[model samples]
Target chain A: MSEIPSKWKCAVIQLHSKPMQLEDNFNRAQGFIRKAAEAGARLAVLPEYSLTSWVPDDPGFADAHVDREYLSKFCELAKECNINIVPGTFVERHVDDGKDMLYNVAHFISNEGKILGSYTKKNLWHTERAHLEAAGNNPHTVMDTPLGKVGLLICWDLAFPEAFRALIIQGAKIIIIPSFWNLLDLTEPAFQRNPRSEAIYLESIVISRAFENVSCIAFANVGGQKESGFAGLSQIAMPLMGDIARAEGAHEQMVIGEVDMEVLQDAEESYKVREDISRPDFHYPVYAKN
Target chain B: MSEIPSKWKCAVIQLHSKPMQLEDNFNRAQGFIRKAAEAGARLAVLPEYSLTSWVPDDPGFADAHVDREYLSKFCELAKECNINIVPGTFVERHVDDGKDMLYNVAHFISNEGKILGSYTKKNLWHTERAHLEAAGNNPHTVMDTPLGKVGLLICWDLAFPEAFRALIIQGAKIIIIPSFWNLLDLTEPAFQRNPRSEAIYLESIVISRAFENVSCIAFANVGGQKESGFAGLSQIAMPLMGDIARAEGAHEQMVIGEVDMEVLQDAEESYKVREDISRPDFHYPVYAKN
Candidate 1:
């Protein structure tokens, strides 16, 4: 087991990114990282597609191979600010068996600026399937970090609890999700009953994941109006306290909260969720080993 | 696939049963079932341990083998009232080999008074483990019923998403949970952080389950004060409109809501969670076939 700190602070930076504006988005994210570091946050997270936004169709946007340089800038920022970072996700073009394939990927960076690990989004949103290929093998990414054993997931992946289960089984204590989730994701007829369906889904899912897995979840989502397709509600949640810190609305801001290992330990003792899963006699669904 | 009705009404009867008062509890449950049927509900659910309140250590309570009689009364009530029922859970004593074992079990009864299926609680609560043996084989119960494909799960089982996944994979469209869940489930330190932590957990989990599975959830919890260990938030939740009807507070009441198959179909199409899981190429967690 990795040595985990008793208490540490983290921040979810909810930012609005302009489509196709890589440098501008990076600079804005950099500003948020500096601010979070100044606020004594040991780890900071950014929203999905923070670099080039989520315009899937534009060939120009797809051709702009900025993932490497974009990641380098985030690594430099992490080292400079002396904090760990999850630089949201960027679209990566990989040639698989002579065909071009695009994958949405999120990376975890250490405070010393080393890339820890990356997770390609396994569950793609309906529209994104047309443009992006979901990760085919060993999709879950859980790695040791200065913050603790951390796991990484992306936007629509939040809807699938199996992804979270796989990570928890692998001993992920702090799961960071970088999402570009939007309220408009629901159909019009469905939304007619409850206008805040997606909002409820985001809040409920985050809290449920924390409590069920007996872990902490830091969700960073883009902020904007419903028309812009951003459901901000970026939040930091632990087992007992659902949302210690959360974005007030769908607006650009940094939400900060503390993760106390003592409280998490107490919850583990009270709930025994991890213990139950670990027992050889107790049967629960887990990802089949490849 | 069973033909599901376009629209139907259901009721979650939040009842507080006196400890060991099997007769009175059955009478009260029958009254509520009649009320629900009068209110045009096709199905009605009761809270766990409704026949004998959850006094785990009472030897007298354990020896009182009322499971058969209690279920008989419920089946008769279903026939009389013309309503399907999930009559909460009962302690069943079954002789395994040479020893007697107690199991916490829930059942699904058709409106015609036939027992559709029974599910023994697989994930026992910390306290429940002492008195009840968790189901060791085929824990999930998803059966064809008048209400289409329905699933039955007991209280603590809600904490494990894998349980829900198993049921959904078995073609359950409406999941019913009979819970004796209480706010006092949390430890002192957890309560200090958020006194309403369990409430948040119950509500959030219900909504999250409904949304994530693209199915309807009827959670029936005992209603009473925190001292009594009843966290009554009995609710009927569907994908888009979470908690269409929920208990006003921790009180004895019947919460009714309409379930529209059309709305469920719309959600299934919008989320495509079922479609994603059904695709053999999309690897997700499911219970190992026995």
Candidate 2:
């Protein structure tokens, strides 16, 4: 295992992708990655479905052929920029028991252009349930990297604390969530009380997850207007400092922040969350049978 | 089971208790309960350690003899005010096997003065772990009440999402937390960045829990100056409205809000979080063997 850096910078690229325009989306993402790398970021993460822009109904959107080429481009970019990359998610088509199925997948690439790990989004959003198959019963994806153990979760998985808990328990020091959440996710009644309800949920949960797990959280979300329903609040949050850097609004931007192991170590000494969870006598009941 | 009201008011009584002044604290808590009931609140909650304050080193603070009488007084107040009560927590000294042990415990009392259920705080704070025994391996306490299936958690337990998950999985619609969180809980380095880090944690986690679980979270915290470390941000939050009512600062006051079942039902329909969790194929890894 390589020695982990004690201090480094990370960036979340909040991109506004053109729906179904793969070339335009890739070009924009590449530009953001270059900017992040130039700004001294060792890791840069993009929003979920950045390549396809979340247009599930578009013709040939789920084609498996496009995914491999798109990932190869991201790998080449990682090597060229000399930065680790989490290039959002792409739809994956696989055959299981003679039936074709689609899954949303994300990959981690090293600066040397190695595919470190690949994770299929386990908890699908309500709408995605209709078109995508989740990787149920699979363990959370936690990969050992030069930055320390890193884990990945997709948009809707943010709502489930269990996913975060599973990763942290596996010794993940940094958890990255690539999200495509929007303001209009909530219903009409909820919007009446607070039009920014979804935004509040995204920000609060991201900060809370960092604090509670005593880990760093990099949340990258898409950018657009309220009418476009893109609730952009991309941020890099730490346990004690909350959001060290956050996007100002629903706009295409790169939010960067320092990820210091010292701060996390101090937080652990103060809170001892991981220590408590590791105690042999510690237990919390789980009602789920499977 | 009794008929649960579709819409009802709940109050979080944020009190500043005098150390070891049980009588004065009881009187103040009773006054707040009467005021809440008069304001049409069907349920009222108090902060943890409200009766004896948080002086753990005080002599006779954990006496078993005083707890029963203190709880009886709360039951009497509940019947007199015609409101359900969660009168914070008390240090309970119980005989286990051949030894005596101390556990931090909370209870739910009906308007009829019946002790519906009792919950021993399972997740003890780092400091408390030295003196208090946690109720490890015990299932979370959720009881059927006129307000619906209600659950209880105390103080530091708020940091552990597993406690909330256990109760919600058992069908808890309303989760009440009695907290004694303080602004000075974070280390010096953390405070240098933001002195309000603990406050942010309390508020964000409360709102996030309500949103993610699609349940009502009523949080009652103590009030005091920053010098005293009290980070009072008592709130009543629901699925749709993040915080229907909240205390403005570290001050003694009662925050009341309406818990509408219709709004929760609408959120459930829109988010379908509960539906997804209930799916047979839903699974997330748990590394803990116990």
Candidate 3:
């Protein structure tokens, strides 16, 4: 047995996924995987709704919008790259909706290209609730990888701490979020069609979750703009008691980094704030409605 | 009356005050006021504890440490510049250690250099419970100003929506807050601290107070450090359907802005969100305690 443990390297790609362009989006995904593997990344994550746009009504496009063939090709790419991949959010025809309506899904594939598992976003965004069906799953689960155990939570799922906590309880060392965050929604509201002041709200949740969990968080997002207008900002953050890294804003290209399991290991020792500070057992009655 | 009524420009100076060095702190504040007056600001505010640090048991410190001679100097300055000044905080000397050990106070002085009224911080921070004593007072009472009816709250007081609502109920068109926020302490270890991963708990209170009340908010904060490393970030945020302007990072300077009473003359008519969405009576309970 080795005295020193090995470190795990993960890559995050922030891209502007062209809406409804399944072929182009798949190709982009394949390219990022190849580059990450070539650069020695053991795993890589993509943004939520990367298979298509978070744009309204695109999931219900023509009959040829999303299919198994598209996913099969992507799976082949993951196998060829020999690295774990989180192909962010995509639309899958729901059984209850008679395949007429779809559910927002996250696909996790192993380096050997075997389907690990999938998670559907539990708390659908107000905009999403307008079109998508809320999934019945718990939305928190950990996958056993060669480097470490990882958890998966989609875009809007960041707002719910309980979901991420559930995954951590299942022994997740790092949390991966695939997001298609539209920038026009927050910063450039004056010029966008639909302006949103929810950036503070979303950013608060992301930051608080990292601090509360004492784990590294990597979020890959769709950035840049479309011919139709709308953009995104991707970020990676760590609320560390010992080692914290937070980087936000537009990163429309491939970005790579290591999850640094050592950070999590050291966090176990340095979390002074978490030691008997928040009395959740007592605050439960108070915070339940909030 | 002229076609264009006389305008009132306000400046909220967010200062980072130290636990010691009273002379230097006052001089730095004077510098900001001079600059604001030169830029045509008629009214300005300072943050809570701008006179002294929030910690207890520092040498030569008392709960009520309001020095009358120094206040006279401020009155002289306001009179010289023909400006209105809000005294952020002071150590008001008191008779009862239990009743008024320390006061989180705000002094609204008119342009004519007359003391209007003072609003002590009603909602004390967690640390305040141990370091200082809370003062009992009317939650909200509007002050008649030459410009309009103005309302006030100290740092922790802003967290209570009812305080702002009480001000609005009395027909306050403008709200001012003098804050002394220590960003470093806001980390998890401090119960008074919000998670620093993002700026939610702090930013949300300021943003919500402005949006819900339909009144302009001018927030001044104490900045810089003295003996310790406490810091501050302050700004003057306008009342819009969403956030108007925000200042991030350590702000030891003055933030000035103008708000046209006409903008809120028919606020319910202009902002469709406030007109259609807001229900003050149905406000969900905020600020729950364990």
Candidate 4:
């Protein structure tokens, strides 16, 4: 086995944003990221819809949504703390649509105050879709940083395998997901239980993403309830295995972990995860293509 | 509401199998399908690799595989039992290979012992890639029978939404997945904690499939270990729900349940599972399509 590299500690900032309180949510997020940095975490991830949540259909949210100024403020904080921060989703103003589009976004800010690329949530949750306009284009892109190739995605995107596969194809060694996941009952209760905790399905997708792509996945979800019954439960998963570090119960909290790129090497050597074990011969098409 | 179709009982036959043992396995599967039919089931589905598991390492599997004779027996059984049977998969004697190439296949048989159409497994599992040959060009085909436009796929195909979408495009109102699901630790533990004693992941897939396609899904899994540590645990899941009838414990067994085709219409109309709620605008592309 190859020698393991110096491990990088990551803090998953799981918290509860009392909807529409921009200042309060920012303070809470700032506090958690600061603690993670103090604990020697090289990077930290915040939850989805954290920037300007309380803004519902009411105009209050329109006034409260996070803007360039808010992101710049957070960038200044990242510089001050010398911690790489993965700021969760924020309602931002789009260039094309002057109207505020709820961008389930993630910002990668370096400890040295360098602003990395931001990832707008590719797949929006149902509620978010109602309020936010879909990102028409802008495919999954990776940011090359000291911490290896980092891929970013927002909440509901994790449910789809193809989205994550796109990130992996872009040479992302670590995939970060910022989420605002809600638990709810489906159409039929007689058919299934555990409606409130779709965590298992989420975990499976993350695990498969990591395993197939051979990349580390860091998922940071906020804890606590908003006007809508969204319970926060942030988690970080290593490549090939799901849920490396997870916070239990719905509480305002943050989870910290490390992404050792060398682990990918080890898992590959041990498990042959990338080996095309899929039977392409049996794939659909009906007739053999020469 | 359009005059509701008469309530039809559908059985999802989970078929866990040993690597080879074509004759014995075929006989066992026949018995279960017959039992399900006798119990008033109008449709029955078997699991992937039911005819012959793709474990290429098994010594007896290569030569002792089932052929025309075995299928002839199944045809006879379907006729005698007077049931609609979907044989999960079988290793067929390749017309050209002569030696015996594994074809992950599904056979649709009528109550009158007539062979309806057959759909080969499209997406083979990763593990099978090591031993089993890839099946080229299998398209999503639907069987227009009494149980609605029944779409059929093997195990891995479910992972790819496009495959099921093709079936839906082809007018498949219901999908039957005959699978040999390799159980992990979490599945058994989750089942142990549940009243129905079924894996949460299995239920998740069934519900997700039903929701995404707006069709009823009846998935049959193999039970009964041949060489592997665990095998049998058959179940039947309805649209937008979970397993209504399932087997218990870790042992091999047959399970049966009824799926009301009307549930699809109900889920689509009042529940509006896939259409009303599912917002594909937020979709992420996983694979790089050519």
What are the root-mean-square deviations of the candidates from the true structure over C-alphas? Answer: 2.1, 2.5, 7.9, 6.3
Query: Considering DockQ, where higher is better, how would the candidates rank from best to worst?
Result: 1, 2, 4, 3
What is model 3's DockQ versus the real complex?
0.09
For model 3, what is the alpha-carbon lDDT of residue B180?
67
Question: DockQ for each of the predicted structures, in order?
Answer: 0.69, 0.52, 0.09, 0.16
Residue A134 accuracy (lDDT) in model 3: 70
- B1-290, model 2: which lDDT tens digit per residue? 56889999999999997788888888989999999999999999999888887778888788833549989988998888889999988888989987899888889999988899989988888778788888886777689987999989998888888888777777888999988888886667767656878887887899999999889999999877757888889999887678899998787888889888777887887788777666555584222212
lDDT of 4 by residue, B1-290 (tens): 13324567777665556566676778778877878888987777777777666566767555444546766787788778877788777765465446656666677877677777887765666566665665555456677765557777777665555577567656678787787765442233332332221143344455556654567777777776434434344555544344566667545566666566665664455334344223344243211112
Candidate closer to the true structure by TM-score (higher is better), 2 or 4:
2
lDDT of 1 by residue, B79-144 (tens): 988889999988888888888889888899988899999989888898887788877665676799
Regarding DockQ, does 1 or 2 come out ahead?
Answer: 1
Candidate 2 chain B least-lDDT 10 residues = B281-290
Give lDDT tens digits, candidate 3, residues B135-233.
Answer: 544446788876678888887565444466566656777888887665544433332222341234355445545544667787776666433333444
TM-score of chain B of each: 0.95, 0.95, 0.82, 0.78
User: What Cα-based lDDT does every candidate model obtain?
Assistant: 0.85, 0.85, 0.61, 0.63
**What lDDT is obtained when candidate 2 is compared to the true structure?**
0.85
Give me the displacement of residue B228 in model 1, in angstroms. Answer: 3.3
TM-score of each: 0.96, 0.95, 0.62, 0.78
- Candidate 2 regions exceeding 4 Å error are A64-67, A187-194, A285-290, B64-67, B186-194, B285-290
Among incorrect, acceptable, medium and high, the docking class of model 2 is: medium
